[model samples]
Target: MMATPAQPDNGNADVRAVERQQVDSPFFVQTLSRELSASPRRIAVAIVLAFTLVRLVWAYALGFGIDESYTIGQSRFLALSYFDHPPLHYWIAHAASVLFGTGWAIRIPTVLMFSATSWSIFCLTERLFGGVAAVFSVLFLNLSLFFLVSAGAWIVPDGPLMFFLACGAQVMVRIIFPSPGEKEPTIIWWILAGGLFGLAGLAKYSALFTLAGLVFFVIATRHRRQLLTAGPYVACFVGLIAIMPVLIWNVQHDWASLRFQTGRGSPQFAPSAFARMVLGQIVWLGPWIAIPLVQSALHAFRKGRTERELFCVALAVPAIGYTTLQALWSGAGFPHWPMPGWLFVFPLLGARLSGRIRPAIHYAITISLLTLTLLVTAVALGGSGALHRLNVPALHDPTEDLIDWSPVAKVLTPLRVGRPDGPAVAGLDWAEAGKLDFAVGEIAPVLVLGRDKRGFATRSDPRLAGRRGLVIVASEEAWAKKGSGLSCLPEDPLPVARVPVGRAGQAELTLLVIPVEGCIGAAQ
Candidate 1:
């Protein structure tokens, strides 16, 4: 190529000027700007406020589904325990129902529990670390896919479990961190902490993770050497004994529920299961997960350990560790297996951009988070058409599906209508029987047990065996295939109704009806 320096006088100079203008264009400037441009505090406030609204509003609009129906039944009955989880949630719901009433009313306690836990997370992180860490942890805890969904949407024992977990953590903070120069924490707070944990144990077994964390901190910090000399363990013992109602329930039922949960079997570990679980946590935790999450972890080894980071990191360890183990083994698990991760929010966030945010930055950040929440909510509620802006699944509506008991129950109800027949109902599938129980009430006869512990536990009690005038319920196909002999049915079965099955959304549930025989042959 020939050098053109001699032509720079006019044409070359004009070309150079045009190149300068191109470099200064708006697109180039915008491309160089920060992806997120808000003050951290504004970001934090916006996230919490938006999450609170979405959860409460969406939850109220929805109807009770399968699990809620069972739990409400348990609460009204106030048993020592249920086949799933524990009895604490039922006991709490029972109280809520007394005041709030059944159906949507009992959910008030769940709503309150969520609010308290959230505030605890906010305060704990802000005090332990710094504004950046606080915001980061809060965003991670609140916005996590599992967490956001569980907090307001689900009516499980987890709501109370999380509440007590947060309450216990807050009290520990006061006791461990102590005001500036205080020598020892007040005895009453320690007692209260013990009591809260005692109740937590009744709510869910996972709460034991918190107690384990406390024991770990005491040993890790070498404070356990003074444990016997410091305070009374009597109050703790009393609180523990207070939850004996659950223990008694277990004892009476041959510990079936607990044994069932503990004895869960899985085939083998899958390499991809652990990987996918981690990926799920990452999306749920959001961007903040990368910062204080990593920084706080490393900060633990520094000369002057980041105290706040330590607390949050230590708190989250149990949940993460347990979930990892559960993923490796074969058994039942849930996305909320990592629930305790939320406890870390306060400390980690307190230590992480916590200063001098601008006004425009606030609105910009709020809008960004709002967009994320909206998209997530859309996917969760089973309508992501508009948000196809992202490549996420569009079908995950947890509640509000009709579940198709109408068809099976449809043909049978009329045949026995106004007649003084027995309350027998039959099912070849668990869903059909459960759905019927939902519609006609659990007292309906012939609620045949499902093959799984979750189903069998409800109806396989000796009390429900071979009752006269019982109705048998199963899917139309299953009923036809095994029409001659159902374990719960008599030798001679009578045809009652042939109900057509239908699909509701993505879920398929159908039922068939037959007369409940007085008795089946031995061991059926």
Candidate 2:
């Protein structure tokens, strides 16, 4: 036994050593650090590319969302601004559609814009924090559900808004807090900041909150002297010039857009609404990421002493604070409203979490990917009618919202062509009109019979008044009520086609396309 003991169990020792190595430094962390160390920019670019690929797949997998359909439908007629948001994304969507044609291709512009946004965030974070933090910031930003799916891929204002806001913040950071030994920011930098901020305003109204943050930073910080210089004023003037289109449009329309926006905030206080809004934001940014972001934001606010900390706190506090408080009013605030302000906190979050050997980030990312995969798979299944076949309840299945009007289009195309009068299509409301309009494409004009027509009201054709067309009512009950009142419709007009507008097996709504003759005014 003593002689045999001399062998010394080398294989067991080797296995133990390898286990210790893994315990000390996870393979994931090691590979991540090694890749990051080689080139942070490359890692950032790779992240952007991978996310973009996912977005492309997602965009094609599901139909346009309600708001996306509305944007696409209304953007066919260009305007200075839109009722729901600024015109930049609408312009982008229109341009993308012109170049690539409609369908999922319209989302390409947004997907690409978010890629630029991620790069901007990376550059900003790197300049303020470090390369590792920058990479993590991009990772976290892309991992967030709202930022990833909605802002990243949807044909909404957030994509362009976030891109411009991030770019503006990066430029402003250079102007406000130049690195040690760096030259004073030139007028060009200020001008660039203003232009970018203005472009952000062109993307969404919430950009003003961020712009206010910038103004406050200058006033509250040691950089107030910059106010004495022409730079700040020039930036303001340039920003004003950039947003002139929105102002002009509002003026021309009797400030209808502004009034509408202001009207969204109800006077009644509701703590439940506030709680819901907060929870919505938490859900939007997954709990893992949101918890860190809140911690970073609070840390910046309470104990931050550095110039970068002051800057971030200044920019972040206003939007997040204001939106959260505004949510106390039952009608005010959306989950994404505070996102612009929260955007400035990501660098802080990156800095706070940088170089930490924690499994949370790894697990968060893994969970996010898994969640996204499950969501995408479910969406694909729903779109393909597989989920429908499983008897998934319409109420329980969220993918029902993703169902497009392609089936409706198939039924309406020949009917539209057969009518010599070339009747306009109509829907009960803006959402219905949007889906129908998108489906009909360039074949016929689309109109909303209801008063809440949104952008459609502004673009309504007078000629559609006297033309006979099909009216799409979602339910038999709805058609029974509204269809009977339209004098132009037959006394007992039969549905041209009963099309299901949701997942194949379980219809969310049944579209009753009743033929009518010149009843637009009465319906309205």
Candidate 3:
């Protein structure tokens, strides 16, 4: 008020104004900064909503995939376990199917599971580092091609596995790195963590790697006292109890499930499998994520180790190592095996990006955002047939597996609609049977021939024992080579129709009307 020499024209305020101008100079950067500055909760919600919208669009646009068809068939009958995976996905699908209906309804649980996984990542990251890291973690995870577009969006076990793993990771973080002035949490956190780990096990056997990671962390950090505590034992008990259904099912069936799962891994190493694993990691996880994972491991080993350092290393190494071992041993295309491994690394990645590696993180975000836009565009165009004009080879056709089965349903409905009580529609294997069933929507009771005991094999219809049915056979090269011209009635069959079902409706499959001469061979 005393005329204060006109405030002395402080140069600091002028410099600050210049700095603000520089910060907001670029329109794109300004927009991103504004977004990042939003409340972490709001940012998380927006990310989840955006990711969910993309998934829902794809779900609505595309028809059921082969695996989805199989899932629906399995969900139709509640079981303690399944031939291919545990029962959680089927259970969720069963509930969704009962509540909403099939088709998109079966996928609703995946969407919700993925949302939960994303939110869990945000929470875990925020707790470990801060809000900015949480946002970055969510973005990196939700934008991954494998995580977002494939397993994360599909109605599969991986969806639930990732959700529970993320929940368990948060609890594990608290156990390993409690904040300052904090007492160790009651056994509740460990109990909850174990329960989540158990649920993850119920989702997929790969969850063993998660538990292994926990052990590795304890051993590496010399935190053997954790073993003496009730937390570890409780976790073990809870996880075992969670997967009790699988164990019970195996016991009743004479350990068939355990035998089958264990038999999958053989000790034959293939260099090509390792190469594929490496390449796939780059493509699906994106270089942004892949690099950070390697960096996190390196930092843990090369620098002073802390609970944080050791935790990140353990979470990623065991899962990735197990996946690599599988791939090298079996030479199977197990690209998504390392998904959970990549998951816990996200927070560490986010922390690194927000700290000294801010420049690299900025570039990664830009690339990932652009890549996501392109992916959405491609998926949309795929539905509209715009991408088909590119004449991509069938082998490389990403949408080949998603071929519209409505045409097949149309042709078979006429043949089966008149014979609902008899063996109506049949397939040479469970996959085709499930596909036909999903497409026809109960126009006929679809049956599978041969010993391919998948989901459809478990369903025995006494009516199908000797009844004649129309068999829909996929036009594989092998089938064509042995062609005696498709037939019906096993003794002297007749070809009812050979309908071509695909993008252009060209006959790629032959529907044979065959009578079940004997008990169609049992599922192998």
What is the lDDT of every predicted structure here?
A: 0.59, 0.79, 0.71
Question: lDDT per residue, candidate 2, 124-171, as tens digits?
Answer: 988888887888888888888888888999888888999999999999
Show model 2 residue runs off by greater than 4 Å. Answer: 1-23, 34-38, 355-361, 385-394, 414-420, 467-470, 473-492, 501-509, 521-524
Q: Name the candidate that leads on lDDT.
A: 2
**Residue-by-residue lDDT tens digits, candidate 3, 47-97:** 888888878876776767778887776677788987778899989988998
| Candidate 1 TM-score to native | 0.74
Lowest-sum lDDT 10-residue window in model 3: 477-486
Q: Compute each candidate's TM-score over C-alphas.
A: 0.74, 0.89, 0.84
Candidates sorted on lDDT, descending? 2, 3, 1
Judge candidate 2 against the unseen true structure and give its global Cα lDDT, from 0 to 1: 0.79
Question: Candidate 2 deviates by what RMSD?
Answer: 5.4
Ranking by TM-score: 2, 3, 1
Q: Quote model 2's TM-score.
A: 0.89
